[model samples]
Target: MSRYQQQSAAAAHVGGAKASTDGRRLRVGVIGLGIGRMHIEGWRQHPQVEVVAIADPDAERLAAVGDAFAITARHASAEAMLGTEALDVVSICTPNKFHRPLTLAAFAAGCHVLCEKPMALSAAEGREMLAAARQAGKRLMINFSYRFSAQSRALKAQVDAGVFGEFYFGRTVWHRRRGLPGFGGWFGTKALAGGGPLIDLGVHRLDLALWLMGYPKPTWVLGSTFDPIARELAAKSGKCFDVEDLAAALIRFDNGATLALEASWAANIGEAELMETRLLGTRAGLLQHNLDEGYRFDAHIFMEQNGAQFDLHLHPEAGEAPSAMHDFAEAILQERPHPASGEEGLVVMEILDAIYASARSGEPVRIAA
Candidate 1:
């Protein structure tokens, strides 16, 4: 058997340590210093959590992050850090390729994991990770950060209140006219990132839409990807770029609902960055979109009352919403379900797999049960 497979099988039998319950702070370790910095900040928000160690393959970046966060226990690899520290939680903020292995390793070490989005390169890998977590009796949460925003939470509250009844169609998109990330690095490499903006940026919007719509089961997908602009740019720079820059898809759900998903790292558009999710329902329609091409977003509800169209703008409550990492820490401390579960991440990965498949086959791909 392969090394990871062996680890996976072993993880099913090894029960990891649970969150501390003796009035002690939870020791946390974060891997991959790039996005791991944010994870550290989020964990610090919880009064019962302390980020004790960090890891990264790049020595320079690792050292810089360690110093900035005042985290003295740092390692050049996850294995070294996991071996040295008795952590209650491990955050896997690595590249797409390392998510599965790191998650399984963390599970084997008896630590709950909070993984970054897209879960892994494929849905199959996501399922394995889920199984490993179940076997270890560990909590596995996905860092679907966008879902923690005030705008998103407000919209979700209304959805739960039945303000938007029986959603039939939804459109979610994240577009960047000239915002290719790490153009010559892993983001542009298909093997490393799994896909371009579709996996990176689109994952957030897709999750937001699905979460608001109660996560309907996707039945089919027809997707297309293009990279003409990225190809030309890569040719000029002489870099290793093999992934699509833009992707669009139409998805059908078993509940007779449909979703239109679009994402692009580079495109001919007015906004430098644009993100929006609109859900059409029987009672009312809801919209959550970014403002001024920036991260701040606004939520709105549209409906007809007294035979007249009306738009109601939503105002978020006073305090700031918790980050996904904060929610993870809270859930573990409270012994409750986290905001974004592994199953939800798996669903997103499955849809992504079908999208890529449909893009390749030039035909609609049916999602397997």
Candidate 2:
């Protein structure tokens, strides 16, 4: 079989066949009261999901959210909630360090999981979570919401159709100016949030690029990370900071494609915030960028016939707002596979691990086969 055929088979394997159901609703429990509030709201909107319980270390936060959502089943900890609440699924929105443990615990409780992004601190942790889900005969999903964007899906369709034939190089960037998150909060702490922009923000773009490229195996990576902005900002705000403010990496795939990734939180750049990806191919090129207030995407296909150069612009239809929680609910209810599975999240984490390793060692790091 050809490479495209192999990719199609693999995609089918990861995304299992859709199973019909009797339209019964699934009960969901959400952990971590911070971003867990968003998950609760999203799940409530789904017709096939019911918010049964909520858990948080902060009783006040949990009570506030539970009251707002009119939910009486609330617990002070995820362990306590899981033991009592009969839930079909759990949303793990805790800190980075706790993702693996929380997800595994949820799986052990016989609940499918919808985990927040970055999956875990490392690929190994992601693997363990995946294993737990498999052993428990449940589903594991990662909430990489960017891939659910309309433009992203449209771009993937065009690429798979060979509209941008033989794509060679791509650039994915997420830059922000003076937007250090949470100042000196847990977001800036290395122990709580892993690395900086690369893992937090760049992970989205990195996953988008790799997914568009059909999740090819990465060969090697060379990268660099800086903490200048975080140090200066922390000094001014009088808070502890121990993560990089800026990071960049060059990743080469086994298919001979190269990706240039750039991410920053305090870079002196033109845009206040930028999230964009540009793909260059043998036949055409594509660009998707987020501008002021909204987003812009352009596709260009070039051809030379009879010594005349021609370029065609293809415009895509507008997309709807995507909710990872809602998608997870529908997937569980319909017995369909989710777009962002545990294996895909592991690939993103593996690349992240390699990027950090390369930045620290000042040498090219090879991805294990």
Candidate 3:
């Protein structure tokens, strides 16, 4: 068999590390030790997934995660891992710098890919990833973790049921009091992270809001960003932080809908953190927000009918929503569309790029068709 086809066939055995009863289970490989650990749990939740290999630039981290997961295949770099292991799927969980190259390599290796948020450092890179996935006829999904929240899933159901007639506007915000991650790490560097809080925190909210709005065609974006808090925080730690602490943008879609998005890693908000999304539609308005800055969320639907107003609430049962990882696995098995496909990620990237561009140019940036 061809090497690529052999890899697909042996996916069931995870390169003989473990035997698959069904023999069709997908062999999964994950890169990046940090978020890659989360990806491991995500894939392991499914019955038809076998985590065969993992890779990281740091050998200590590579061995640590591999040991923790009982995975024997470990490599110091993605190139080495891809070359050595026969994998059916690979998760790219590294920093923003490696997203594009790893995704392309995964495609070339005849493996489907699940990439972390923000897709890549730029819209252009996201486009390249999309094209590579398409050219290789491989599935590509982005892990927009927020969409898998029970609150978001329930609100989406309400919208899909026509409870919210026509989405007109939305405001999504995620702010943290002092949550600048890895001050001296790649996240604090503009070159590695692309931007800062907007790309990190705002991307989640933007994706959730845009998904609810049915992926509207954005026409233009006006944005502003600040690095005030990071500056003070970094000086105290004697480190340098070059990215923004806060970012806000107004994006106009061709369907006459507008969305206001704000994100910040270090803000003076009294709360430790806050995350919320409010959507306005012709029939009703919907709200989904976390309580007390915790992960769990509550959702409410507001409707006025026959001169009467009603507020509907949702109490999602535990595990009401399947995780993005689970859904991505199912898509591969069923040969169906992934929940958060690369195309969607690319569109979100375009909006984010416009946001940063607008912030730089101090004017609205038009999104080209």
Predicted structure with the largest TM-score when compared to the true one:
1
Candidate 2 lDDT by residue in tens digits, 22-77: 87878899999777777887787787789999999898998899899999998999
Candidate 3 residues lying further than 4 Å off, grouped into runs, are: 1-23, 236-238, 316-320
Q: Pick the candidate with the highest lDDT.
A: 1
* Residue-wise C-alpha lDDT for candidate 1, range 105-164, written one tens digit per residue: 998898999998879999999999999989888888888888888888888889989988
Candidate 1 colliding pairs: 16-110
How high is the CA lDDT of each candidate model?
Answer: 0.87, 0.81, 0.85
Order of models, best lDDT first:
1, 3, 2
- What total of clashing residue pairs does each candidate reach? 1, 0, 0
- Looking at candidate 1, the ten consecutive residues that score lowest on lDDT are 3-12
Model 1, position 143, has a per-residue lDDT of 84
Which candidate, 2 or 3, has the higher TM-score? 3
Clashing pairs in 2: none
Model 2 accuracy (lDDT, Cα): 0.81
TM-score per prediction, in order, is 0.94, 0.88, 0.92
Residues 1-369, candidate 3, lDDT per residue (tens digit)?
221121100011112122234547888999997877878888988889999999888989988888888999888889999998989889998889889999999988988889999899999999898888767877778888888877888888888899999999899999989888867888888899898999888999999999998899999999999988788878898876888999999999998999999999988888777989999999999998887666668889999989999999886663556667788877677655578788888889999999989999999999998
